[model samples]
Target: MNAYLTLGSVALFLALVAAVAVALWYRRRNDRRTHSLHQLLELADCLEGDLKTCRAGLQQAHAVMSLNPDLPAASEQEARHAIEAGLRSLLQQRIWIRDQAPRASQDQLDRAVSNMIETRSRLGPLLKALDQAQHALDDAMREHIIQRGPEA
Candidate 1:
């Protein structure tokens, strides 16, 4: 009788240990997934700031182009439209990310984040074009000022 009771107690203790270990594993997994979601949200915010900066640069280029008609008209127009389209797309992406992050599965979050990053790469060309347009506009304005003297 005593041996049987001892065996049953040991079995119950082992079961409790296993249950605790499994619980801990699940908790850690949930934590990791939550961390990934937070990271995605942070990246989305940073990208939005970058897009805004690019938009501002494009606006500046447009203003400069307006003030100096001799600047590359075609390039300025292209840059403006490209930046506008980029902003629209970025906004849409941010909306999707925000809407989906909270209740998303780990695999889905991973794919969404990776895809967002890939799409962001496309914005690089648009930003580069904006920079080039700005430089050309600045050069034209400088030349005009120099030709007209300090007082114009």
Candidate 2:
């Protein structure tokens, strides 16, 4: 009877240790997932802000076109194409990160974030072109408005 009780106590102690270890592991894993998710969210927010600016530029371009129909410069069109491509790339990365986050290890999550940061560099020239396009479009729209009466 003494031996049996000792064995039972050891088993119970081993189970408690295992439980605690598992709980600690899960907490660390959850923290990693949360960190990755936060990174993704931050990246997405930056993309969305840039997208908003691009949308406004496009709208201004559309307004200019409505007045002249042929006012879009070749550079403006090229810039728009580049911006669109960058946006598509960002969207794909976002999807990949979200899909992998549920099952990926901490290293994998970090790799994904690093890959996304590298991809984001392509946005630099695209954003510059977008700014130029916005300025051109703004000028075009202003010119159209000035040429026409306030009734327009």
List the global CA lDDT of all models. 0.77, 0.75
TM per prediction = 0.76, 0.56
Candidate 1, 1-152: lDDT as tens digits = 99999999999999999999999999998997887777777767767777787878867867776776665555666756866776787678667777866777889888877876776677668778768867877887888999989985
Error of 2 at 35 (Å): 2.2
TM-score (C-alpha, index-matched) for candidate 2: 0.56
> Could you give candidate 2's per-residue lDDT for residues 4-42 as a string of tens digits?
999999999999999999999999989878988799779
Error of 1 at 4 (Å): 3.0
Clashing pairs in 2: none
**Highest lDDT scorer:** 1
> Lowest lDDT 10-mer window, candidate 1?
68-77
Model 1, residue 16: what's the lDDT? 100
lDDT against true structure, model 1: 0.77
Error of 1 at 136 (Å): 5.5
